[model samples]
Target: MLKRKLLTYALISGLSFSMGSSFVHADVTKLRLAVETTPGDPLNIMLASFRDTLQSSAEEEVELEFFEGGALGSESDLIQLLRAEQVQVLPIGSDIVELDSNFAIFDMPFMFADKQTARDALDGELGELLADSLREKSGLEVLAFGELGFRIISNSRRPINTPEDLSGLKLRTPGSATRILAFEMLGAAPTPMSLGEVYIALRQGVLDGQENPLSVLEEFSLYEVQDYVSLTNHVYTPITLTMSANSYAELSPDMQEHVISAAQEGAYQTRQLSDTSDAELVEAFTSAGVAVNQPDLASFQTASVPIREAIAERLDAVFWEQAQNILEPR
Candidate 1:
């Protein structure tokens, strides 16, 4: 199955490049988009929609070639490639916060009451502020915001019903400093690791558990190694659709418009897919023998208050306030 998936993308890359080159009469704007995630992940889903929309709307004016499943390397390596213009676009994960701490605003635990509230902020000024900061700091232009969705903790140990339930469990988290601190405050020993390494670690007893959206848990097959899931709805992670500044500047104005509009469409599609897919994915986990529970978030939220204050000064003052205004409870 994995071999077939790789061969499919290889054909896509070759065909896209050939189509772009064969347009002798008209100049084709070629863009390379890479991601560490596999084809069916939400990040790739958004990019696939973005690519198709661009193709249909622009009609040979633009061609997008994908290098997915970490073909180019980790998200960190991909960022360096974007800066060097080796790749034109990427759907960057929370590792982006490492570039500019202001992006950490999205890493706050229990920040949004629901996915809709998170979408409202990402599609509004709060998102704009972080995007502008990213451009200034790293020269990547943000096109749209998609999601990694709200994360829930799953473990091999026990069903987590409260913050106390998390005590001393070595949980695998993404490489986000704020996220690490958030888990620590909730009483878990957070271990930072890449998604690709998580399954073996869980199965071999190197990790007690990890947190992610249900889609990710299913996509990565992490549920196979775990026994319990606690729907803490702990953090809402946004994947930023970004283009290299060099690539954007080189595009004709009309082509740039096509890219941006297509990105917005893809972003909306991802949110809709995530909203609908969770209910089904949850059942799949239960059927696989993984116990599931939706714990009351009040206790988790209470434990996270001090961590919020701790990271407050680490973020941009203005951006922090704006984020709170958009996502904080009414």
Candidate 2:
């Protein structure tokens, strides 16, 4: 994939754009979008929609291509490539913490009420706050926001119906300190691991349980191994679509607007798709025989108070205040 992109880079490098022009006809600018989910997963489905939308809306102005299911690399590897300008755009899930720790605000336990509330916070000023951090700290332009859905806990050991049930269970979490801390506060032993290793770990008894949205449970087929799934909707994670600032800078202002607008449309599509798919995915998991149960949500929410305060003290105060203002609204 890198070689193909490099070749395309060379081919387009010689094409010169005339300044003050509203559009560029010099060469086709294909925005290569990367994600770690497989073809049927919501992200890929959204990417296909993104491609069609970009083609129809900007047929001559630009193009969009996708390398899904970790084809380019894990989100981490892809970020390095995005920084190097090897790829133009990639949708990131939790790894946004690595880009700007302010994003760790999302990992705070039991933050958003539901997918719609999460979308409103991100689509409003709060989203721009994190986007500003990324552009300033990482040279990435925030194109739009999508949904990873709310994360639920699934286990092989037994049912997790409360915070106490989580005690001593080795739960697989992303390699984020905030996530690990969240699990610890909820009385589970958080095991930080890459998503690729999770299935094998569960099969080998290396992990007791893990958490993710229903789509991921379906995508990874963890339901095949894990006997029980506890709907402990602890965190609502948003997928971020972004481009390298340098790439955005190189395009004519009008073309730049097109890329951002196309990405935003794709993101809006993904959010809508996710909202509709979550209930169906849950029902499918239940039919597949994965024990699904909703724990007392108030217990989980109450347990999160100190965890919120503790992590907030560790993160940038401005970002924390921004989150509070958006969620609670001035």
Candidate 3:
């Protein structure tokens, strides 16, 4: 009887140990990162760095999966997923923030003077402030800001040499209030559409033309459907790498630090690639039979001034002033 009782106790202990071990292994952290950019885009190159770094440095098996090319859905869809903890991370366009009016500050027309100005503002105090504000207000942690280059105008109608040339032309823009207003203020009809639908719409003539970074223009092969590529360089658009606050809080402290560091490195590498690859992208677009034009940017800048005022009224003057201070030379 004593031997049988001891045997039963041992069996129970072994079962409990086995169950605990299984639970621990099953709980190993796995992350699913989503990017709207295509596989060959610079953003993907940056994300690859993060995946590689996390895999190498993580103590446990940290499985990093990617959903690219809008497979996970539009930026807005992914943002909602992050809020619901349905996905882990998203490197999305700045326009995604238009869902909240406060985010419109980033989209203020001609906000950053040039790519260099954009980079400086993003990597400096302004970037940190914006990231913190998003975290506090939107419930997401901003890991780092990645560059998508300055937006350019492309249409089959004609070359957009000045704001006057864009008059009466229908331009496709993301569903951001600031962007719509910016295009309208510039005298173009702004049509808000999902990124996934853009290609078909452009091909079918459902839309007249679109504005995007050269990298995106090349990625979606927009150069094929469009004729003229104006280097408007009007808006310096930045993509944000964001993670869910809930998922972030669930991570171990060490893991959290590792992830944040990796994300920062990814953003830096992406920005570097964008800086170096612009010339190559322009050349590629030209070679593909797309007419490239570097217009008189001063006119476009002058036309967008009204857009800034309109946005400031809705987003607050303080936010606009702070952004300007960051962009202006110290």
Candidate 4:
């Protein structure tokens, strides 16, 4: 059995976790997994599945400590904890682009025709390239890529039927340069903030709109504050399950297999959940008295051309070309 020595205290975002406070048998190995998402959010669901899968299949005793709802802090803060070996695993969203800009490809508007196309590319060569770049640049292990689904716009303002309707509206987005630039090109004033701050900002009129997967509306109870739901379906983001290299390296080979297998299983469940949630949430939002509209995507797609072209030029030429080739019509 593989045994891990526990640190007495690990600090993250000014919070300390007592890893060694609890007694454990010498044969038990503890894994720390966290996400900044709410309890029922996709990221949290995936993490729970990973923990269950790993514990069920592992040869030795596996103890997992699950932290959710920004308990450890924001996604950025979680990344830092992983880097410091304070946290062993994290499921991160597009904020990961900050770690390696190569992931900014996900921020490109209208990039994926559908989830399958996006999944195909990510489960194939393009995924490998991005994973390799991240591993080489940051000593993290990319276990699996789970779906964040396609991002749609939600607003307290009037219904958005076209890109013109977004004009001058203050939209909250993650701190992604390409994503912000895309919204700017579409005529919205983009505001970058942490996920935890978005709801209050919208409620207080600091942001007129925000974009995220439909599940976010239900997960964060955003429907109460946002009146209109625009089916922009602009960007498809994937949450990556990443492990600290230090933690992964310390695992025995058999235990490492358990980790990888569990991650893949959890990722698959998230993809299925995203596909079903999109259709169901539309009806849920409408019943909640929110006006939902399908915007003129052609106009949005047309306006997105420059940003795509610009991102292609900024990214590695080989990766860009190969990603295009992999995502091309079959």
- Write candidate 4's Cα lDDT for 181-218 as tens digits: 88888789999988878888999999998999999878
Candidate 1: tens digits of C-alpha lDDT, residues 40-157: 8998888888888988999967766788898877777677666766677789777888878988876777778888888888888778888889889888899999988998999999
Name the best candidate (by TM-score): 4
Please list all clashing residue pairs in model 2, or write none if there are none: none
CA shift of 168, model 2, Å? 1.3
Select the stronger candidate by TM-score from 1 and 4. Answer: 4
* Candidates in descending TM-score order: 4, 1, 2, 3
Give the lowest summed-lDDT range of ten residues in model 1: 17-26
Candidate 4 clashes between residue pairs 3 or more apart in a chain or in different chains: none
List model 3 lDDT by residue over 61-137, tens digit each. 57776777766555665666566565677776756565446667666767776777778778887887687767777
Candidate 1 wrong stretches, greater than 4 Å: 1-26, 326-330
Clashes per candidate (backbone, < 3 Å): 0, 0, 0, 0
Score each candidate by Cα lDDT.
Answer: 0.84, 0.79, 0.76, 0.84
Cα error, candidate 1, residue 8 (Å): 24
Q: How do all the candidates rank in terms of lDDT, highest first?
A: 4, 1, 2, 3
TM-score computed on alpha carbons, candidate 2? 0.89
